[model samples]
Target chain A: MHELPILRSIVGVALRHAVEAGASRVLAVDVKVGELRGLDAAWIQSYFDFVTEGTPAAGASLRLKESKALFRCRSCGATFPPGPHAGGDVACPHCSSKHVELASGNELLIESIDVV
Target chain B: MAEIRTIDIKEAVLSENAGLADRLRRRLMESGTFLLDVMSSPGAGKTTLLLETIHRLRERGIRTAVIEGDIESTVDAEKMAAAGVKAVQLRTGGACHLDAAMIEAALHELAPGDYDMIAIENVGNLVCPAEFDTGAHRRTMLLSVPEGHDKALKYPLMFTVVDCLVVSKTDYLPGSDFDLAALRAEARRLNPTLTVFEVSARTGDGMQGWCDWVADGIRGVADARDGALDC
Candidate 1:
């Protein structure tokens, strides 16, 4: 549902960079998305294609790199993937402490753009 | 022909909106107004809960305003205005969530200086709204009894981002199989610092604590501003 708006921003970023770099056209937009974001990469690509029409990024391919959600244990200072904690209890793998902080996973960024 | 080249932009997709949201937060704080963003799935009793909260805040003499975000219709905003509090309705058309620019426009109409606090009822969604920052001082979400305990697992991002969680519609808890403990545990796992409140706007169960929390937030902002002025 929100893919359009999200793609709009992504295309905006890619185009801005391409124009700033004096590129005539954008070839591809690389995005780093966290698993926790739950965004469908295919949906984003379809919307990107629609919104970027008639723009410098019209034919750009959207390449998404997904990152896993990791939790950092406050007690042990160890970061581990959330996959290991599928038991409903997200305890630290190193120290088994319940006191853990989400270190990363909510990322949504335009990593780079291939242009000419 | 120009050769293909890769440019490392390394920019967050929502950076522009985030920058605007941060600036809005600063501007609201400087005006001594605290903004709270309330989010939840539809029919989670956000409006009812907020109506009760508004009544309680009024009793405490805390001037408050509301910004209602909906995909369509002004029904919620009208209800808020009927309660005698200043209200603004943002129609997002087909957008799933409200972003900083929308909130900033609403605040312009609100003249937030007159209010101690402003509460924004975000569009009913468990996903998209969590992705956008609305420049609110705090973010809270409601999960009704019927929504089930599995929501934390199903929508972990929403549970992770919110500062507070209100388990609304507790009046139905008696006949339902809603496992409050499991929900709490799961939510806490996602967000250890999350504040949980079990409330039923209809029966008024646990409204005091929630209302008091809101009132305290309002006063805290006012007090902080006063302290800043004194310094």
Candidate 2:
């Protein structure tokens, strides 16, 4: 949970990777975060800002791609997006069955980092 | 002056974290310590299980240390220390998960040769921990009875990455109307390779299995390191 230390390390690794990949300055870093992972995008961006200091990634923009939690019904093989309604439980829109398996929305992938 | 040249460099943001994780893994292997990452939702008995595990391990003379990750506060670390274990708190300041670099820094604060095992208790979030690998030899996800059975399906990635699935708070089974079999079936379906254990840190139920697995993992790591050294 040490955001600064971890983010600093991540930035360091990312900058190193970028340099090794023939990059000078990173323009942007795109990351995907899933809802179930419970990550706050704003917080991550802030942390990125703090950690990227003095690194090749300094001043680089952090773009977060948020994925929603979706559930696939196991009984009817129906896939549906999670309801926007409040509360955590969501009933299947297709079969109206509670036997749903969650799909997507808990992703943390460094999709792409734009560099020059 | 009119012309300008620009270069396009597309890289992965997590490449750096992944690289560090790989290095940490190698170092852990070399040091004969098997790292275990524990993750779950907030108040899902992560600290309780950790406390009990640390106590049990100490009783058996297995030297262990903990890296407690939280968004803020050293309460968990304090609790672990009170139980007679060397524990350090790594405050995220609000980040959802623990990454390799934070763990690497924490390692510098501890005596490397003092402990035979290391447990990184990640921030109590299922999502980010799944994405960021902290170079642990094994990852374990805890699901408490109050959290419900749909967690595995809801948080598939967390379930998928973990080497073991611990269903904590077994003693509260009578109070909560949880479908244990269904949860197990769903978890197995998602991750067939996952080793499932039911534990109640409060009552000390089904903890032996958990401890045994830990011992076995440590022994396996030690044996591998010894074999490599012998070679």
Candidate 3:
């Protein structure tokens, strides 16, 4: 339900390119969503089917690849993933610095599209 | 039969929104307006905080206007009027968040140059509100004591995206189990650049500091404009 707007964006991007390419139909759309984005592939696919009806991306499949979050320690310059911490309870393994910074993994992007 | 083809387009799914937000920012900055998008869950004292901030800013002779975004009803806008401020309500009708387009419309309605500072009170939602950008210079997220400290952990995206984390309802801290240090620690770890503030609308405990921040933002923009004109 929360993915509708994002799904619309995905469909818009795919169809725009597919139409520019003069493609009759879109086969699939591959997206890279970060874990923090909180969008599931299956749910978006089900939503994609309804939102893409009668468009170039009609019946197109939705593919999603999730990215993991990366964190960098601010005090020690150590980089690590969040380990069993809510609000970062653990310290950096390299230097025991608790001051960690999020490096990545909050991406919600479309990587490619399959058109036919 | 048309031959099958593969297209390589690695575009951000929300590029359109991002682009519009950038353009809006440029527009606001050029017009000498400072915009802040305020967000939080329902009952997190957003309106209460806004009322206090606006009243205090007015007392200091700072011109401020508001854009109230809600699912429905103009109750919040009415409250703004009670504070003797100008506010244009953007009723989402049911949308959980206010996007750039909605803000664009509201800005025009408010008209530029009338108010140097503008605050957009986004729909009371912790999730979807963080996803959309309302073309503000900074995004503020409010976390009340009743909301719990673990919110920074349960809702990482919202907490991570905000520029300032305002802990509202601090007047109730004595009765609640909220830990300011632990919560700020996690929030800072998520985004080291984030600024934290503790405030209570009912008691006006930290409103002065929050108001100062707002005033500083407006003054910074105004000073730059003055410098540009001088040259």
Local distance difference test scores for all models? 0.88, 0.79, 0.85
Candidate fnat values, all: 0.71, 0.13, 0.63
Q: Between candidates 1 and 3, which one is better according to DockQ?
A: 1
Candidate order by TM-score, decreasing, is 1, 3, 2
Clashing pairs in 1: none
Worst ten-residue run, lDDT, model 1 chain B? B184-193
Residues B14-64, candidate 2: write the lDDT tens digits.
667778999998888888888889999998999999889988987888899
How good is the docking of model 3, as DockQ? Answer: 0.53
Candidate number with greatest lDDT:
1
| Native contacts present in candidate 2, fraction | 0.13
- Which candidate model has the greater lDDT, 1 or 3? 1
Give me the chain B TM-score of candidate 1. 0.95
Candidate 1 regions exceeding 4 Å error are A83-90
- Candidate 1: lDDT of B32? 94
Candidate 3: give the clashing pairs. Answer: none
TM-score of chain A of 3: 0.79
Model 1, B1-231: lDDT tens digits are 889999998899888889999999888888999999999999999999999998987888888899999999999999988888788999999899999999999987988899989999999999999989999888999999998878988898898889899999999999788998888878877776788999999999999999988877777777878888899
DockQ, every prediction: 0.60, 0.13, 0.53
Best by TM-score: 1
